[model samples]
Target: MEENIRRNKIVGSRRFSNYFWTIFLFIGGFSFLLAGLSTYLKINLLPFANPTQLAFIPQGLVMIFYGTLSLSFSIYILLTLFWDIGSGYNEYNKLENLVKIVRKGFPGKNREILLTYPLNSIKSIGIKISEGLNPKRIVYLCLKDERKIPLTPVQQPNSISILEEEASDLAKFLDLKLENL
Candidate 1:
């Protein structure tokens, strides 16, 4: 039917892993910062450790530097999580004979990214799988103009079968071929 439409929602930085990292970084950084301050002031700022015995020149300064770096990284992650960046949906509308890909970006004029193309322009659905240190499983929409738009989120890697099934399902819905790359 020409009125048929399909939509798939994608998750973003609001996942459990992101939350865990944010909390971990914040706690670790705060601890280091307190320890460094305790050494400089000759006082026990951290309840767990007596950093007043540590030297203020190198050890305390190094701790402060590392703490700053960790806090900055955690803040960046927190902002992304708050914004729910990269969260969006893919819509295949048979009625309009079009496909729409939408995603959220950083706070700016181009925060919301929306890409639309004719449904017929979809050449195939592609699945890419890689293992080892940095494992990745991703699904991509291959277009006629040689553009490959990734559909899957960059979180935990999905199983091979799951990736294959998702790609096949999308390919069938779009009436396009499925390619395993």
Candidate 2:
């Protein structure tokens, strides 16, 4: 039972992340560009008209404050984008690590199992689709619970059967009574 078996092989979508960063870059770049254009044209685009006359502070100070705030927000979003870019997608390995199988009663049941893994302990989790171009989805396998003998990814379309197999196997392995949903 301890023989290593690599099972989960689901990959997450990077397109969504890419699109998010692209949008942020456009917005941030435009913001800075507009700020530069405003300075070059000597146009006060502040929300309030004649801000210099309304505020006791100098116009330059107000521009500095607004520019700094916008740039800071942009910087933060860009930093997250870069981090995601650096940590590329990875394949899930279920063989070497312990795995857990959870069964919840029909929707709205309060039953659940709480399991924790070291911050980076999990290799990855698997997300399965029903068929080519189908919207149906399911979480195929959870990488660590220290109870069940991790099941291999089901090549078939039925996820419920796979879940049942994993849960029963896990219950026997842990010697605990787990009711199936």
Candidate 3:
């Protein structure tokens, strides 16, 4: 997914494929769960169902266990999707002189937790690149107190130019130092 940079804020939405997998899992899990429930209820929807079958009880028990597990996983995925998990935003409020980072979480009355820092506390913004089999690139805001707060999500195949541009933009907007690393 791409990041949207405005004059005062940056928002990063989760990738489409991420949502697709969650939906896929939710549906598949529910189907498996339903099959298990059918077996447990002794209500055979299949044409091969025979009331006199000796294995029905054992089959039902196994199905119930499998179905419960699948259904539980599917439910977790569904709830996280609704909660907009993994989507986050960083905002710069000029008038208030505050920088805010909002991270979305599980569904609730208010599922977001907002962290605010004074504008003066921000020291610099830099890109962190870790290269290996599973490479990662993240932009972090370095604070005066030596705390590094990640500004962007873990990016795959992180290009130095892109991270540099984003970090510089943020650094400039906040009137802070830019560290290219």
lDDT of 3 by residue, 50-103 (tens): 432424467656655665676676666656656557677777776677788888
Best by lDDT: 1
Find the 10 residues in a row with the least total lDDT in model 3.
1-10
Against the true structure, whose TM-score is highest? 1
Backbone Cα, N, C clashes tallied per candidate: 0, 1, 0
Give the residue spans of candidate 1 off by over 4 A: 1-3
Which pairs of residues have clashing backbones in candidate 1?
A: none
* Residue 4 in candidate 3, Cα distance off native in Å: 17
lDDT accuracy of residue 133 in candidate 1: 100
What are the C-alpha RMSDs, in order, of all predicted structures? Answer: 1.4, 12.8, 5.2
Pairing residues by index, what is the TM-score of model 3? 0.69
TM-score of 1: 0.96
lDDT of 2 by residue, 1-181 (tens): 4333323332212235545755675565555445544554567554434333333235444555565666666666555444432222122224434343332222234434323333234333344344566534344333345322223322234565665565555434333344421
- How should the candidates be ordered by lDDT, best one leading? 1, 3, 2
List of clashing residue pairs for candidate 2: 99-145
Lowest-lDDT window of 10 residues in candidate 1? 1-10
Ranking by TM-score: 1, 3, 2
Q: Output the better candidate (1/2) by TM-score.
A: 1
